[model samples]
Target: METKILPRILIGAPGSGSGKTTVVCGILQALINKGLNIVSFKCGPDYIDPMFHKEALGLESRNLDLFFNDKETINYLLAKNSKEADLAVIEGVMGYYDGLAGKSYEASSYDLARSTKTPSVLIIDCKGKSVSILAEIKGFMELESDSNIKAVILNRISPMIFEEIKKLIEETLPIEVLGFMPMIKECSLESRHLGLVTAQEVGNLETILDTLAKQVSESIDLDKLIRIAKTASKIEFIKPTIACGERVRIGVAKDKAFCFYYQDNLDLLSEFGAEICYFSPLEDKKLPENLQGLYFGGGYPELYLKELEKNDSMKQNIKDALSAGTPCMAECGGFMYLHEVVKDKLGHAYKMVGTIEGESFYADKLVRFGYIDMEAEKTNLLCEEGMHLKGHEFHYWDSTNSGDCFHAQKPLRKMNWKCVIGNENLYAGYPHVHFYSNIKSAERFVDICRKRKTKI
Candidate 1:
């Protein structure tokens, strides 16, 4: 199959808290409103911002992490998604320079930009610094000489400061000043201890997004921005390698509590003839009847512990499904939801599905973080016994006890800690695995689900 490449734009910041999220969200909404099918991508292991992007653009926003998958796969995913859209906009992680230690260049935004050959637009917070902003842009440009920095968007600036900073940046750097937006006095996105609140949690996210789009459209030079994005060099596309399979229906938990998912994962499942049905664990009375498989992605299950505890019938339903030999694959927050108990930061405990015999407690410090390379020590639905998968772990909770039913194994750590566990027909882990890293994991998972469905 021939690949199709689209005009692309990469939005990044100097570091965290530089208003990248707000700016990116606004950009996504504005472009989407222009009747362009805008496919979005988030740079690192983030679930929340992608949700907002999806909400803004009405498209499935995918993650592009160099740590989890090879460059070939990343290129394939970018090309695959680009086919369905007029343009693609990727939001970068932490600073453009921040990435894993040993694999710094691999996981950084610069890597993604280079691999995809996408032009980048730096969103610099011009709150206090005026003249120094040029130096920051120069440093970023020089840090990666091959990087195609098309433009700079000055954020959090007053009118006086915006003009001063804009003039200095254009005079000092060899890049165009795309636009600027003043720091607005509006109710911003809610955040938790980790980061911004998940899009599922925001009640009026549509209104918030509309407000954001209007703000960007009113503030930024939309025409110049589009032209800059169009100037990105187009690269040859690569089609995803889809394995042959019979059509299977999979029930995916997708609500405020369990919203972490990759667009590519879903696309892979679709490519393999699996029909995905999304159900909310928070609102759904029970799982879809006679579903072939259950996929519970990661989210802020800790925040809605009380509500989850109240849904005793739903908890029991999931426990019964697992006990009946239904294959299940769960990531960090989803893994916690299957445990016996999940305690919040306040030490209040809530009853979970009890499929996995463990109690998860919120710790003051981060337990596991960063990329991991895992070798499956035992057979499970997600991977064959000895198959290796690259993934990452980012969480604050620690499992103090795993009751007699479950066991953790094959611990791997580079910068963060990771472990896998199994109980009943379910395989759970702290490391958030993206199926793009190993398509075999998805195929194996669906195969187990098919077998379980036949038995039923």
Candidate 2:
């Protein structure tokens, strides 16, 4: 097979608040306006960054998580999604060098750059210092044994200062100074417990993107960026085989409240002969008629407590459907919704479907966050007993009855706990799973749904 020539560049930062998202969104909007097909990607297990990409470019952004996904999967996704696009831009997760922990670069943005053989542009926040910034950039470049970093983008720096710094940086380091981006206070996105507030909450998204596009077009050099993206080496990938089976109708809960799902997860379901029927738990009166199973993904359900609670008919309908032997899978916010009550950040309790026992409380701090390996404590719709699944856990809430159906253990922290309620028909909990972690997980779910369809 001929190798695909992928023109890709990763936008990364020194640390978290280095204006990587702003710069990435700006560049995407600017490129799209120039009539270039742009496919975006996020480097980690982030759902919100991709949402922002969709809002900016109207193209569905995918993920390239090095933590759970292998090099082959990464190349396949990069090539598959970039087929017709002019260029693909992947925004980094954390710092360029930071990874799973302080020690290993297992799942860092740099790892994604190396794994995909893509070049990275490090964004530096030159807010309060000048010469000090150069030291930082030099450190980032030299610290990493293998240099995937090719360029530097200065953020929150004046044009005059950028020119001076650019000269100093170019003369000293063997990297290009892409451009400088001014701080746009008006275009700042809101932040919550789980990173930025989703695109759903941003009312003036288009307006913001337009502003960013205009600013980026004038400030940054798009032609240079395209050239940098094109510098990526040729890569080869073998497409993985999709599962084939009996067709089944799966009701997927999609909306502002349940929007945190991996794009691959849904793609795998469809490949397995699932006719996805998307219904809004926020707006829909009831579930889709005659569903073999239901999927409730993670999101900010607690934020819309009043609206979710007001829809009594839909809540009871879901509870009733579960009781009627319909297979159900819920995670985090979705899991919270299945409890007797869910508390808002303000500590106000709202009644929810009581399929699962106990009240889900919104704790101020993160509850068992980071990646983990989940072993099925017993047989479930997704996995068999003793089946191992790798996924991440990110939430600021906890349930009294998290269940003991699965045993979840985090590698670095050496932490372990019981989670999920699963059987041949149902699986629900706080851990947001990536279907690729265990392909059989999605396979089993679809198989269970197929059996449900047979009963009907």
Clashes of 2: 0
TM-score for each candidate, following the candidate numbering? 0.90, 0.96
Candidate 2 C-alpha error for residue 156, in Å: 0.7
User: What's the true lDDT of residue 397 in model 2?
Assistant: 90
Best by lDDT: 2
Error of 2 at 132 (Å): 1.9
Which residue pairs show collisions in model 2?
A: none
Give me the candidate number with maximum TM-score: 2
Per-residue alpha-carbon lDDT of candidate 1 for residues 1-456, written as tens digits (9 for 90 to 100): 454547888898888888888788887888888888888898987776777766645776888888787777887777766666778889999888777763366688888898878889999888878777888899989877787777889988887667777777787778899788778646354243126465555676678778878988987887888787787776665565667577678888988788778777877777777789888889988998768888888888998898899888888888888887777878888989999999988998898999877699988887656666766666666766667777766789878642222222322322323366753356687667788888887777777767776776
Backbone clash total for model 1 is: 0
Residue 403 displacement in candidate 1 (angstroms) = 10
lDDT of each: 0.77, 0.86
